[model samples]
Target: MKKIMFNDKFSLTQAVLEGRKTMTRRIVTYPLKFRGVNVAGYFVCKRPSGEVTEICMYDEDERMIDGGQILPKYKVGEVVAIAQSYKDLGYDPDSLDRDPKDLGIRGFMKHSAGWNNKMFVSAAACKKHIRITGVKCERLQDISEAECLKEGIEEHLKGIQYGFPSNIGYIGQYPFSNPREAFSALIDKVSGKGMFASNPYVFVYEFKLID
Candidate 1:
Protein backbone atom coordinates (compact mmCIF):
# COMPACT_ATOMS: atom_id res chain seq x y z
CA MET A 1 0.00 0.00 0.00
CA LYS A 2 0.99 3.62 -0.49
CA LYS A 3 -0.06 6.92 1.07
CA ILE A 4 -1.09 10.36 -0.21
CA MET A 5 -1.13 13.41 1.97
CA PHE A 6 -4.19 15.63 2.32
CA ASN A 7 -4.20 19.02 3.94
CA ASP A 8 -6.92 20.38 6.19
CA LYS A 9 -6.81 23.88 4.77
CA PHE A 10 -9.31 23.12 1.96
CA SER A 11 -11.40 20.87 4.17
CA LEU A 12 -10.48 17.83 2.09
CA THR A 13 -9.55 15.93 5.22
CA GLN A 14 -12.77 17.05 6.79
CA ALA A 15 -14.72 16.05 3.74
CA VAL A 16 -13.22 12.59 3.92
CA LEU A 17 -14.00 12.45 7.59
CA GLU A 18 -17.60 13.40 6.87
CA GLY A 19 -17.83 10.71 4.20
CA ARG A 20 -18.57 13.35 1.59
CA LYS A 21 -15.49 12.63 -0.55
CA THR A 22 -15.03 9.34 -2.32
CA MET A 23 -13.20 10.45 -5.44
CA THR A 24 -10.11 12.49 -6.21
CA ARG A 25 -8.26 13.87 -9.24
CA ARG A 26 -4.48 13.72 -9.43
CA ILE A 27 -2.41 15.71 -11.92
CA VAL A 28 -0.17 13.78 -14.27
CA THR A 29 3.39 15.13 -14.33
CA TYR A 30 3.82 13.81 -17.92
CA PRO A 31 7.04 11.90 -17.28
CA LEU A 32 5.07 8.69 -17.77
CA LYS A 33 2.63 9.57 -20.52
CA PHE A 34 0.25 7.46 -22.52
CA ARG A 35 -1.38 8.19 -25.84
CA GLY A 36 -5.06 8.09 -26.76
CA VAL A 37 -8.36 8.59 -24.93
CA ASN A 38 -9.96 6.10 -22.61
CA VAL A 39 -13.19 4.61 -23.92
CA ALA A 40 -15.16 2.26 -21.73
CA GLY A 41 -12.36 0.23 -20.14
CA TYR A 42 -9.77 0.50 -22.89
CA PHE A 43 -7.40 3.17 -24.10
CA VAL A 44 -7.77 3.56 -27.84
CA CYS A 45 -4.67 4.83 -29.60
CA LYS A 46 -4.70 5.88 -33.20
CA ARG A 47 -1.66 5.05 -35.29
CA PRO A 48 -0.83 5.44 -38.96
CA SER A 49 -1.32 1.75 -39.66
CA GLY A 50 -4.31 1.15 -37.44
CA GLU A 51 -5.58 1.45 -33.92
CA VAL A 52 -4.03 0.03 -30.77
CA THR A 53 -6.08 -0.68 -27.69
CA GLU A 54 -5.44 -1.91 -24.18
CA ILE A 55 -7.33 -2.16 -20.95
CA CYS A 56 -7.11 1.19 -19.25
CA MET A 57 -4.98 1.45 -16.07
CA TYR A 58 -3.31 -1.90 -16.52
CA ASP A 59 -0.39 -3.56 -18.25
CA GLU A 60 -0.88 -6.07 -21.05
CA ASP A 61 -0.77 -9.02 -18.66
CA GLU A 62 -3.28 -7.35 -16.28
CA ARG A 63 -1.04 -7.42 -13.24
CA MET A 64 -1.39 -4.48 -10.87
CA ILE A 65 1.44 -2.06 -10.21
CA ASP A 66 2.80 -1.77 -6.69
CA GLY A 67 2.01 1.66 -5.23
CA GLY A 68 5.38 2.28 -3.59
CA GLN A 69 6.70 4.63 -6.28
CA ILE A 70 5.12 7.28 -8.46
CA LEU A 71 3.21 5.69 -11.31
CA PRO A 72 0.85 6.57 -14.10
CA LYS A 73 -2.22 5.53 -12.13
CA TYR A 74 -3.41 3.61 -9.09
CA LYS A 75 -4.91 0.21 -9.65
CA VAL A 76 -8.23 -1.12 -8.41
CA GLY A 77 -8.10 -2.80 -5.00
CA GLU A 78 -4.82 -1.07 -4.19
CA VAL A 79 -4.94 0.25 -0.65
CA VAL A 80 -4.08 3.93 -0.15
CA ALA A 81 -3.36 5.39 3.25
CA ILE A 82 -4.61 8.93 3.72
CA ALA A 83 -2.02 10.91 5.65
CA GLN A 84 -3.74 13.15 8.20
CA SER A 85 -3.19 14.70 11.61
CA TYR A 86 -4.38 12.81 14.67
CA LYS A 87 -3.12 10.93 17.68
CA ASP A 88 -2.63 7.22 17.38
CA LEU A 89 -0.58 4.32 18.61
CA GLY A 90 2.94 3.47 17.37
CA TYR A 91 3.66 7.13 16.50
CA ASP A 92 4.56 10.30 18.35
CA PRO A 93 3.54 13.69 16.99
CA ASP A 94 6.02 15.38 19.33
CA SER A 95 8.94 13.70 17.58
CA LEU A 96 7.99 15.52 14.35
CA ASP A 97 9.90 18.60 15.45
CA ARG A 98 13.59 18.93 16.40
CA ASP A 99 12.96 18.60 20.15
CA PRO A 100 11.54 15.45 21.68
CA LYS A 101 11.18 17.05 25.11
CA ASP A 102 8.62 19.58 23.86
CA LEU A 103 5.79 17.19 24.55
CA GLY A 104 3.35 19.44 26.46
CA ILE A 105 4.11 22.64 24.57
CA ARG A 106 1.59 23.99 22.07
CA GLY A 107 2.43 23.64 18.35
CA PHE A 108 4.96 20.99 19.32
CA MET A 109 3.04 17.87 20.24
CA LYS A 110 -0.05 18.51 18.19
CA HIS A 111 0.18 17.59 14.52
CA SER A 112 -3.03 19.52 14.07
CA ALA A 113 -1.21 22.70 15.05
CA GLY A 114 1.33 22.55 12.25
CA TRP A 115 -0.79 22.37 9.16
CA ASN A 116 1.94 23.41 6.72
CA ASN A 117 4.58 21.04 8.01
CA LYS A 118 5.47 17.81 6.24
CA MET A 119 4.47 14.82 8.36
CA PHE A 120 5.21 11.13 8.06
CA VAL A 121 2.96 9.02 10.22
CA SER A 122 2.94 5.30 10.64
CA ALA A 123 0.42 3.27 8.61
CA ALA A 124 -1.33 2.50 11.88
CA ALA A 125 -1.89 6.20 12.50
CA CYS A 126 -3.76 6.72 9.25
CA LYS A 127 -7.45 6.82 10.09
CA LYS A 128 -8.58 6.49 6.50
CA HIS A 129 -7.85 3.83 3.90
CA ILE A 130 -9.38 3.75 0.45
CA ARG A 131 -9.63 1.05 -2.16
CA ILE A 132 -9.53 2.27 -5.70
CA THR A 133 -12.71 1.20 -7.46
CA GLY A 134 -12.27 2.90 -10.82
CA VAL A 135 -9.73 4.94 -12.72
CA LYS A 136 -9.74 6.96 -15.96
CA CYS A 137 -7.71 9.55 -17.79
CA GLU A 138 -9.13 12.76 -19.27
CA ARG A 139 -8.62 16.48 -19.55
CA LEU A 140 -9.16 18.45 -16.36
CA GLN A 141 -11.90 20.54 -17.92
CA ASP A 142 -13.89 17.47 -18.75
CA ILE A 143 -15.11 17.23 -15.14
CA SER A 144 -18.81 17.78 -14.91
CA GLU A 145 -20.90 19.27 -12.11
CA ALA A 146 -21.98 15.83 -10.98
CA GLU A 147 -18.36 14.78 -10.87
CA CYS A 148 -17.50 17.86 -8.85
CA LEU A 149 -19.95 16.87 -6.17
CA LYS A 150 -18.29 13.50 -6.05
CA GLU A 151 -15.06 15.40 -5.41
CA GLY A 152 -16.68 16.62 -2.19
CA ILE A 153 -18.27 19.89 -3.28
CA GLU A 154 -20.25 21.13 -0.30
CA GLU A 155 -23.19 23.48 0.01
CA HIS A 156 -23.04 27.30 0.05
CA LEU A 157 -22.66 29.73 2.94
CA LYS A 158 -22.71 33.47 3.53
CA GLY A 159 -19.84 35.75 2.32
CA ILE A 160 -18.40 32.98 0.23
CA GLN A 161 -20.18 32.77 -3.10
CA TYR A 162 -19.08 29.18 -3.78
CA GLY A 163 -16.69 26.52 -2.43
CA PHE A 164 -16.62 23.70 0.06
CA PRO A 165 -17.76 25.34 3.29
CA SER A 166 -14.89 26.45 5.50
CA ASN A 167 -13.73 24.35 8.40
CA ILE A 168 -15.38 26.74 10.83
CA GLY A 169 -18.71 25.90 9.12
CA TYR A 170 -18.87 28.16 6.11
CA ILE A 171 -21.04 27.45 3.03
CA GLY A 172 -19.09 26.11 0.00
CA GLN A 173 -15.73 25.85 -1.89
CA TYR A 174 -16.07 28.53 -4.59
CA PRO A 175 -18.12 31.52 -5.63
CA PHE A 176 -20.21 29.84 -8.28
CA SER A 177 -23.81 28.72 -8.57
CA ASN A 178 -23.14 25.24 -9.89
CA PRO A 179 -20.72 22.54 -8.92
CA ARG A 180 -18.74 22.61 -12.19
CA GLU A 181 -17.97 26.29 -11.83
CA ALA A 182 -17.13 25.80 -8.18
CA PHE A 183 -14.83 22.95 -9.13
CA SER A 184 -13.05 25.13 -11.70
CA ALA A 185 -12.41 27.68 -9.03
CA LEU A 186 -11.20 24.97 -6.67
CA ILE A 187 -8.64 23.75 -9.21
CA ASP A 188 -7.48 27.33 -9.63
CA LYS A 189 -7.07 27.77 -5.90
CA VAL A 190 -5.16 24.53 -5.35
CA SER A 191 -3.18 24.37 -8.62
CA GLY A 192 -2.75 28.11 -9.31
CA LYS A 193 -3.25 30.10 -12.52
CA GLY A 194 -2.74 28.67 -16.05
CA MET A 195 -3.53 25.24 -14.67
CA PHE A 196 -7.23 25.13 -15.43
CA ALA A 197 -6.68 27.12 -18.58
CA SER A 198 -3.98 24.72 -19.66
CA ASN A 199 -6.53 21.91 -19.47
CA PRO A 200 -3.84 19.31 -18.77
CA TYR A 201 -4.64 15.64 -18.87
CA VAL A 202 -5.51 14.21 -15.48
CA PHE A 203 -6.05 10.90 -13.80
CA VAL A 204 -9.39 10.72 -11.97
CA TYR A 205 -9.88 7.99 -9.46
CA GLU A 206 -13.12 6.75 -7.92
CA PHE A 207 -12.65 5.17 -4.54
CA LYS A 208 -14.42 4.15 -1.35
CA LEU A 209 -13.13 4.12 2.18
CA ILE A 210 -12.32 0.68 3.48
CA ASP A 211 -11.29 1.79 6.96
Candidate 2:
Protein backbone atom coordinates (compact mmCIF):
# COMPACT_ATOMS: atom_id res chain seq x y z
CA MET A 1 0.00 0.00 0.00
CA LYS A 2 1.80 3.10 -1.23
CA LYS A 3 0.46 6.65 -1.43
CA ILE A 4 0.74 9.20 -4.25
CA MET A 5 0.06 12.86 -3.79
CA PHE A 6 -1.78 14.99 -6.40
CA ASN A 7 -2.66 17.76 -3.98
CA ASP A 8 -2.66 20.64 -6.45
CA LYS A 9 -6.12 21.47 -5.07
CA PHE A 10 -7.24 18.06 -6.42
CA SER A 11 -7.21 19.21 -10.02
CA LEU A 12 -4.73 16.52 -10.91
CA THR A 13 -6.55 14.15 -8.58
CA GLN A 14 -9.81 14.93 -10.28
CA ALA A 15 -8.10 14.24 -13.62
CA VAL A 16 -7.28 10.74 -12.40
CA LEU A 17 -10.86 10.09 -11.34
CA GLU A 18 -12.15 11.34 -14.68
CA GLY A 19 -9.75 9.17 -16.71
CA ARG A 20 -8.19 12.24 -18.30
CA LYS A 21 -4.83 11.56 -16.65
CA THR A 22 -2.96 8.31 -17.02
CA MET A 23 0.68 9.31 -16.87
CA THR A 24 2.94 11.17 -14.46
CA ARG A 25 6.63 12.13 -14.49
CA ARG A 26 8.83 12.55 -11.43
CA ILE A 27 12.31 14.02 -11.14
CA VAL A 28 14.97 11.60 -10.03
CA THR A 29 15.91 12.46 -6.46
CA TYR A 30 19.41 11.26 -7.22
CA PRO A 31 21.53 13.18 -9.70
CA LEU A 32 22.39 11.61 -13.04
CA LYS A 33 25.98 12.70 -13.61
CA PHE A 34 26.15 11.29 -17.11
CA ARG A 35 24.65 12.25 -20.47
CA GLY A 36 23.78 10.30 -23.67
CA VAL A 37 22.55 6.73 -23.55
CA ASN A 38 25.30 4.24 -22.85
CA VAL A 39 26.33 1.68 -25.45
CA ALA A 40 23.57 -0.46 -23.88
CA GLY A 41 21.04 2.36 -24.33
CA TYR A 42 20.79 3.79 -20.78
CA PHE A 43 22.66 4.97 -17.68
CA VAL A 44 22.35 4.40 -13.93
CA CYS A 45 22.42 6.38 -10.70
CA LYS A 46 21.59 5.61 -7.07
CA ARG A 47 19.46 7.36 -4.51
CA PRO A 48 20.74 8.19 -1.01
CA SER A 49 18.70 5.16 0.09
CA GLY A 50 20.85 2.96 -2.20
CA GLU A 51 18.03 2.31 -4.66
CA VAL A 52 19.22 2.06 -8.26
CA THR A 53 17.86 4.47 -10.94
CA GLU A 54 18.19 3.77 -14.62
CA ILE A 55 17.58 6.76 -16.87
CA CYS A 56 17.13 7.02 -20.64
CA MET A 57 19.90 9.57 -21.07
CA TYR A 58 20.92 11.65 -24.10
CA ASP A 59 20.82 15.06 -25.80
CA GLU A 60 20.04 14.96 -29.55
CA ASP A 61 22.06 11.85 -30.41
CA GLU A 62 20.53 8.53 -29.32
CA ARG A 63 23.94 6.91 -29.71
CA MET A 64 24.26 4.27 -26.97
CA ILE A 65 26.66 5.09 -24.13
CA ASP A 66 25.72 3.51 -20.70
CA GLY A 67 22.81 1.83 -18.77
CA GLY A 68 21.48 -0.15 -15.71
CA GLN A 69 18.12 -0.96 -14.08
CA ILE A 70 16.27 -0.36 -10.78
CA LEU A 71 12.82 0.96 -9.97
CA PRO A 72 13.50 3.20 -6.96
CA LYS A 73 10.04 3.94 -5.60
CA TYR A 74 7.21 2.40 -7.66
CA LYS A 75 7.34 -0.69 -9.84
CA VAL A 76 5.19 -2.14 -12.57
CA GLY A 77 1.89 -3.75 -11.46
CA GLU A 78 2.07 -2.08 -8.03
CA VAL A 79 -1.21 -0.55 -6.89
CA VAL A 80 -1.01 2.80 -5.09
CA ALA A 81 -3.62 4.99 -3.43
CA ILE A 82 -4.26 8.66 -3.99
CA ALA A 83 -3.46 10.79 -0.99
CA GLN A 84 -6.58 12.90 -0.37
CA SER A 85 -7.88 15.20 2.31
CA TYR A 86 -9.48 13.54 5.33
CA LYS A 87 -12.62 15.58 4.83
CA ASP A 88 -12.92 14.30 1.25
CA LEU A 89 -12.45 10.75 2.46
CA GLY A 90 -15.03 11.30 5.23
CA TYR A 91 -12.63 10.19 7.98
CA ASP A 92 -13.00 13.31 10.05
CA PRO A 93 -12.86 12.02 13.64
CA ASP A 94 -14.02 15.23 15.24
CA SER A 95 -16.80 15.67 12.65
CA LEU A 96 -17.67 18.89 14.47
CA ASP A 97 -20.30 17.05 16.54
CA ARG A 98 -18.49 16.85 19.87
CA ASP A 99 -19.55 19.24 22.62
CA PRO A 100 -17.48 22.44 22.54
CA LYS A 101 -16.71 22.09 26.30
CA ASP A 102 -15.34 18.53 25.93
CA LEU A 103 -13.18 19.43 22.96
CA GLY A 104 -9.71 20.54 24.11
CA ILE A 105 -6.49 21.42 22.30
CA ARG A 106 -5.85 17.89 21.01
CA GLY A 107 -9.42 17.56 19.76
CA PHE A 108 -9.15 20.91 18.03
CA MET A 109 -5.88 19.84 16.48
CA LYS A 110 -7.73 17.03 14.71
CA HIS A 111 -9.81 19.73 13.06
CA SER A 112 -6.76 21.74 12.09
CA ALA A 113 -5.91 22.63 8.46
CA GLY A 114 -3.39 19.81 8.36
CA TRP A 115 -6.20 17.27 8.46
CA ASN A 116 -7.12 18.28 4.94
CA ASN A 117 -3.55 18.17 3.73
CA LYS A 118 -2.78 15.31 1.34
CA MET A 119 0.62 14.49 2.89
CA PHE A 120 -1.04 13.34 6.11
CA VAL A 121 -3.50 11.00 4.36
CA SER A 122 -2.81 7.27 4.53
CA ALA A 123 -3.07 4.78 1.70
CA ALA A 124 -5.23 2.42 3.70
CA ALA A 125 -7.81 5.17 4.16
CA CYS A 126 -7.94 6.19 0.51
CA LYS A 127 -10.99 5.50 -1.64
CA LYS A 128 -9.22 6.01 -4.95
CA HIS A 129 -6.35 3.88 -6.20
CA ILE A 130 -4.30 3.44 -9.35
CA ARG A 131 -2.14 0.59 -10.58
CA ILE A 132 1.15 1.30 -12.27
CA THR A 133 1.12 -0.26 -15.70
CA GLY A 134 4.41 1.01 -17.04
CA VAL A 135 7.57 2.87 -16.02
CA LYS A 136 10.47 4.34 -17.92
CA CYS A 137 13.18 7.00 -17.82
CA GLU A 138 13.40 9.92 -20.25
CA ARG A 139 14.16 13.61 -20.47
CA LEU A 140 11.32 15.71 -19.06
CA GLN A 141 11.30 17.88 -22.19
CA ASP A 142 11.11 14.87 -24.51
CA ILE A 143 7.47 14.25 -23.67
CA SER A 144 5.33 13.55 -26.75
CA GLU A 145 2.11 15.20 -27.88
CA ALA A 146 -0.01 12.18 -26.96
CA GLU A 147 1.71 12.11 -23.60
CA CYS A 148 0.61 15.66 -22.90
CA LEU A 149 -3.05 14.67 -23.37
CA LYS A 150 -2.51 11.78 -20.99
CA GLU A 151 -1.25 14.28 -18.41
CA GLY A 152 -4.73 15.90 -18.45
CA ILE A 153 -4.13 19.06 -20.46
CA GLU A 154 -6.78 19.35 -23.13
CA GLU A 155 -6.33 21.05 -26.50
CA HIS A 156 -8.54 23.97 -27.38
CA LEU A 157 -7.50 24.35 -31.00
CA LYS A 158 -10.03 21.63 -31.79
CA GLY A 159 -12.48 23.26 -29.34
CA ILE A 160 -12.81 23.32 -25.58
CA GLN A 161 -14.42 20.44 -23.76
CA TYR A 162 -17.40 20.89 -21.49
CA GLY A 163 -16.70 21.27 -17.75
CA PHE A 164 -12.94 21.47 -18.30
CA PRO A 165 -10.61 24.21 -17.15
CA SER A 166 -10.13 27.00 -19.62
CA ASN A 167 -6.95 26.51 -21.60
CA ILE A 168 -5.27 29.80 -20.78
CA GLY A 169 -1.55 30.35 -20.18
CA TYR A 170 1.35 32.67 -20.94
CA ILE A 171 2.61 30.09 -23.45
CA GLY A 172 -0.11 30.50 -26.07
CA GLN A 173 -3.42 32.14 -26.97
CA TYR A 174 -6.68 30.29 -26.11
CA PRO A 175 -5.29 26.89 -25.21
CA PHE A 176 -1.60 26.19 -25.75
CA SER A 177 -0.12 26.55 -29.22
CA ASN A 178 0.72 22.88 -29.00
CA PRO A 179 0.84 19.95 -26.61
CA ARG A 180 4.49 20.37 -25.67
CA GLU A 181 3.97 24.04 -24.85
CA ALA A 182 1.06 23.24 -22.54
CA PHE A 183 3.01 20.44 -20.92
CA SER A 184 5.95 22.75 -20.35
CA ALA A 185 3.79 25.06 -18.28
CA LEU A 186 2.37 22.09 -16.38
CA ILE A 187 5.68 20.39 -15.46
CA ASP A 188 7.20 23.71 -14.41
CA LYS A 189 4.41 24.22 -11.89
CA VAL A 190 4.26 20.65 -10.68
CA SER A 191 7.99 19.98 -10.45
CA GLY A 192 9.44 23.47 -9.84
CA LYS A 193 9.69 27.01 -11.14
CA GLY A 194 12.23 26.21 -13.87
CA MET A 195 11.84 22.47 -14.38
CA PHE A 196 11.13 22.77 -18.10
CA ALA A 197 14.20 24.90 -18.62
CA SER A 198 16.39 22.55 -16.62
CA ASN A 199 15.33 19.58 -18.82
CA PRO A 200 16.24 16.99 -16.22
CA TYR A 201 15.94 13.26 -16.60
CA VAL A 202 12.79 11.90 -15.02
CA PHE A 203 10.90 8.72 -14.32
CA VAL A 204 7.63 8.43 -16.19
CA TYR A 205 4.86 6.35 -14.66
CA GLU A 206 1.85 5.21 -16.66
CA PHE A 207 -1.11 4.24 -14.48
CA LYS A 208 -4.80 3.48 -14.51
CA LEU A 209 -7.26 4.43 -11.79
CA ILE A 210 -8.83 1.37 -10.13
CA ASP A 211 -11.25 3.04 -7.77
Candidate 3:
Protein backbone atom coordinates (compact mmCIF):
# COMPACT_ATOMS: atom_id res chain seq x y z
CA MET A 1 0.00 0.00 0.00
CA LYS A 2 1.12 3.58 -0.72
CA LYS A 3 0.35 6.74 1.21
CA ILE A 4 -0.48 9.89 -0.77
CA MET A 5 0.07 13.32 0.71
CA PHE A 6 -1.93 16.50 0.07
CA ASN A 7 -0.67 19.93 1.03
CA ASP A 8 -0.14 23.36 -0.45
CA LYS A 9 3.11 22.16 -2.01
CA PHE A 10 1.65 19.04 -3.68
CA SER A 11 2.31 19.42 -7.39
CA LEU A 12 -0.83 18.24 -9.20
CA THR A 13 0.10 20.11 -12.35
CA GLN A 14 3.32 18.16 -12.62
CA ALA A 15 1.50 14.93 -11.93
CA VAL A 16 -0.93 15.63 -14.74
CA LEU A 17 1.87 16.49 -17.14
CA GLU A 18 3.79 13.36 -16.31
CA GLY A 19 0.73 11.16 -16.53
CA ARG A 20 -0.06 12.60 -19.94
CA LYS A 21 3.40 12.03 -21.35
CA THR A 22 3.77 8.55 -19.91
CA MET A 23 0.17 7.56 -20.67
CA THR A 24 -0.13 6.31 -17.06
CA ARG A 25 -2.63 7.25 -14.41
CA ARG A 26 -1.59 8.13 -10.86
CA ILE A 27 -3.25 6.42 -7.88
CA VAL A 28 -3.22 8.40 -4.66
CA THR A 29 -4.27 6.64 -1.47
CA TYR A 30 -4.96 8.31 1.85
CA PRO A 31 -4.88 7.04 5.44
CA LEU A 32 -8.27 8.35 6.52
CA LYS A 33 -11.11 5.96 7.10
CA PHE A 34 -14.75 6.66 6.31
CA ARG A 35 -17.53 4.92 8.22
CA GLY A 36 -15.03 2.46 9.68
CA VAL A 37 -13.83 1.60 6.20
CA ASN A 38 -10.43 2.43 4.70
CA VAL A 39 -10.91 4.74 1.71
CA ALA A 40 -8.91 4.22 -1.47
CA GLY A 41 -9.21 5.59 -5.03
CA TYR A 42 -7.30 6.91 -8.09
CA PHE A 43 -7.56 9.61 -10.80
CA VAL A 44 -6.84 9.39 -14.53
CA CYS A 45 -4.95 12.16 -16.31
CA LYS A 46 -5.67 13.18 -19.90
CA ARG A 47 -2.75 13.77 -22.18
CA PRO A 48 -1.71 17.02 -23.92
CA SER A 49 -3.63 19.62 -21.91
CA GLY A 50 -3.35 17.63 -18.64
CA GLU A 51 -6.77 18.69 -17.35
CA VAL A 52 -7.93 16.39 -14.48
CA THR A 53 -8.78 13.93 -17.34
CA GLU A 54 -11.12 11.50 -15.47
CA ILE A 55 -11.97 9.94 -12.13
CA CYS A 56 -12.06 6.27 -11.36
CA MET A 57 -14.10 4.85 -8.45
CA TYR A 58 -13.54 4.95 -4.67
CA ASP A 59 -12.83 1.49 -3.32
CA GLU A 60 -11.65 -0.08 -0.06
CA ASP A 61 -9.33 -2.98 0.71
CA GLU A 62 -12.18 -4.98 2.26
CA ARG A 63 -15.08 -4.06 -0.03
CA MET A 64 -16.65 -1.38 -2.21
CA ILE A 65 -18.30 1.60 -0.64
CA ASP A 66 -20.75 3.96 -2.33
CA GLY A 67 -20.77 1.70 -5.36
CA GLY A 68 -17.00 1.90 -5.72
CA GLN A 69 -15.04 -0.34 -8.07
CA ILE A 70 -11.53 -1.07 -9.31
CA LEU A 71 -10.39 0.66 -12.49
CA PRO A 72 -7.83 -0.77 -14.87
CA LYS A 73 -4.86 1.50 -15.54
CA TYR A 74 -4.72 3.20 -18.93
CA LYS A 75 -2.18 5.34 -20.74
CA VAL A 76 -2.48 9.05 -21.38
CA GLY A 77 -4.23 10.30 -24.57
CA GLU A 78 -6.31 7.15 -24.24
CA VAL A 79 -9.95 7.45 -23.25
CA VAL A 80 -9.98 7.24 -19.46
CA ALA A 81 -13.11 5.83 -17.80
CA ILE A 82 -13.25 8.24 -14.89
CA ALA A 83 -17.01 8.41 -14.97
CA GLN A 84 -20.09 7.90 -17.08
CA SER A 85 -21.54 10.67 -19.16
CA TYR A 86 -24.93 11.73 -17.87
CA LYS A 87 -25.63 12.97 -21.36
CA ASP A 88 -25.05 9.52 -22.77
CA LEU A 89 -27.77 8.25 -20.45
CA GLY A 90 -30.14 10.77 -21.99
CA TYR A 91 -31.70 12.14 -18.82
CA ASP A 92 -33.30 15.52 -19.45
CA PRO A 93 -33.16 16.62 -23.06
CA ASP A 94 -33.69 20.24 -22.14
CA SER A 95 -31.08 20.28 -19.38
CA LEU A 96 -27.53 21.03 -20.43
CA ASP A 97 -25.16 18.11 -20.49
CA ARG A 98 -23.44 17.47 -17.13
CA ASP A 99 -19.67 17.87 -16.94
CA PRO A 100 -17.23 16.48 -14.35
CA LYS A 101 -17.39 19.80 -12.49
CA ASP A 102 -21.17 19.91 -12.16
CA LEU A 103 -21.86 17.12 -9.68
CA GLY A 104 -22.43 18.66 -6.26
CA ILE A 105 -21.96 21.35 -3.63
CA ARG A 106 -19.11 21.73 -1.11
CA GLY A 107 -15.45 20.71 -1.51
CA PHE A 108 -13.52 18.26 0.70
CA MET A 109 -10.11 16.77 1.33
CA LYS A 110 -9.52 12.99 1.08
CA HIS A 111 -7.08 11.05 3.33
CA SER A 112 -6.53 7.32 3.63
CA ALA A 113 -3.95 4.75 4.76
CA GLY A 114 -2.04 5.20 1.54
CA TRP A 115 -2.31 8.97 1.62
CA ASN A 116 -1.37 11.20 4.56
CA ASN A 117 -2.21 14.77 3.50
CA LYS A 118 -3.92 14.52 0.14
CA MET A 119 -7.16 16.34 -0.66
CA PHE A 120 -9.97 14.95 -2.79
CA VAL A 121 -13.22 16.25 -4.33
CA SER A 122 -16.36 14.24 -4.63
CA ALA A 123 -17.36 13.19 -8.15
CA ALA A 124 -20.53 15.24 -7.80
CA ALA A 125 -18.68 18.18 -6.25
CA CYS A 126 -15.95 18.00 -8.90
CA LYS A 127 -18.64 18.10 -11.58
CA LYS A 128 -20.30 21.08 -9.97
CA HIS A 129 -17.33 22.95 -8.49
CA ILE A 130 -15.63 23.04 -11.88
CA ARG A 131 -18.71 24.71 -13.33
CA ILE A 132 -18.83 27.20 -10.47
CA THR A 133 -17.04 27.83 -7.23
CA GLY A 134 -18.79 28.22 -3.83
CA VAL A 135 -22.10 26.59 -2.97
CA LYS A 136 -25.42 26.49 -4.78
CA CYS A 137 -28.48 25.95 -2.60
CA GLU A 138 -30.59 24.87 -5.56
CA ARG A 139 -28.19 22.08 -6.54
CA LEU A 140 -27.87 21.07 -2.88
CA GLN A 141 -31.61 20.58 -2.44
CA ASP A 142 -32.93 17.11 -1.61
CA ILE A 143 -29.49 15.95 -0.53
CA SER A 144 -28.38 15.07 2.97
CA GLU A 145 -25.13 16.37 4.45
CA ALA A 146 -23.69 12.86 4.28
CA GLU A 147 -24.51 12.68 0.60
CA CYS A 148 -22.87 16.03 0.02
CA LEU A 149 -19.71 14.82 1.68
CA LYS A 150 -19.72 11.76 -0.52
CA GLU A 151 -19.88 13.95 -3.58
CA GLY A 152 -16.73 15.74 -2.49
CA ILE A 153 -14.87 12.49 -1.88
CA GLU A 154 -15.92 11.03 -5.21
CA GLU A 155 -14.76 14.14 -7.05
CA HIS A 156 -11.45 14.26 -5.23
CA LEU A 157 -10.65 10.66 -6.14
CA LYS A 158 -11.37 11.61 -9.73
CA GLY A 159 -8.95 14.57 -9.50
CA ILE A 160 -11.41 17.21 -10.73
CA GLN A 161 -11.27 19.12 -7.45
CA TYR A 162 -8.97 22.11 -7.45
CA GLY A 163 -6.19 22.58 -4.93
CA PHE A 164 -4.30 25.63 -3.70
CA PRO A 165 -2.66 27.65 -6.45
CA SER A 166 1.16 27.74 -6.51
CA ASN A 167 1.11 31.11 -4.82
CA ILE A 168 -0.74 29.90 -1.69
CA GLY A 169 0.75 28.19 1.36
CA TYR A 170 -0.53 25.91 4.13
CA ILE A 171 -2.65 27.76 6.65
CA GLY A 172 -4.13 25.11 9.02
CA GLN A 173 -4.03 21.46 10.00
CA TYR A 174 -6.10 18.79 11.96
CA PRO A 175 -6.18 15.05 12.65
CA PHE A 176 -8.91 12.39 12.56
CA SER A 177 -9.61 8.73 11.84
CA ASN A 178 -13.09 8.98 10.38
CA PRO A 179 -15.54 11.53 9.01
CA ARG A 180 -17.22 11.82 12.37
CA GLU A 181 -13.95 12.60 14.02
CA ALA A 182 -13.16 15.41 11.61
CA PHE A 183 -16.74 16.63 11.15
CA SER A 184 -16.43 19.63 13.43
CA ALA A 185 -13.15 20.72 11.92
CA LEU A 186 -14.18 20.15 8.31
CA ILE A 187 -17.48 21.97 8.85
CA ASP A 188 -15.52 25.18 9.07
CA LYS A 189 -15.49 26.17 5.43
CA VAL A 190 -12.29 27.61 3.99
CA SER A 191 -12.74 30.61 1.75
CA GLY A 192 -10.38 29.82 -1.09
CA LYS A 193 -10.22 27.99 -4.43
CA GLY A 194 -8.16 25.15 -2.98
CA MET A 195 -7.60 23.34 0.36
CA PHE A 196 -4.92 25.65 1.76
CA ALA A 197 -6.46 28.85 3.08
CA SER A 198 -10.03 29.98 3.73
CA ASN A 199 -11.41 33.27 2.55
CA PRO A 200 -10.71 34.81 5.97
CA TYR A 201 -7.20 33.40 5.57
CA VAL A 202 -7.49 31.12 8.57
CA PHE A 203 -5.33 27.99 8.80
CA VAL A 204 -7.05 24.58 9.14
CA TYR A 205 -5.41 21.37 10.21
CA GLU A 206 -6.56 17.71 10.25
CA PHE A 207 -4.97 14.29 10.91
CA LYS A 208 -6.53 10.86 10.41
CA LEU A 209 -5.81 7.20 11.15
CA ILE A 210 -3.29 5.63 8.81
CA ASP A 211 -2.77 2.21 10.33
Best by TM-score: 2
> Candidate 1 — worst ten consecutive residues by lDDT sum?
46-55
How close is each model in CA RMSD to the real structure? 9.8, 8.6, 20.1
lDDT of 3: 0.26
Ranking by TM-score: 2, 1, 3
Over 2-50, each residue of candidate 3 has an lDDT whose tens digit, in order, gives 1122212323222222231111112232335657865556232222223
Once fitted onto the true fold, the runs of candidate 2 whose alpha carbons sit more than 4 angstroms away are 31-70, 92-114, 157-174
The sequence of per-residue lDDT tens digits that candidate 2 reaches over residues 31-75 is 234454223234343333233345433323553333433354788
Candidate 3 Cα RMSD (Å): 20.1
| TM-score of every model versus the real structure | 0.62, 0.68, 0.16
What ranking emerges by lDDT with the best candidate at the front?
2, 1, 3
Query: How many Å off is the CA of 111 in candidate 1?
Result: 9.5
| Candidate 3 wrong stretches, greater than 4 Å | 1-129, 132-145, 151-173, 189-211
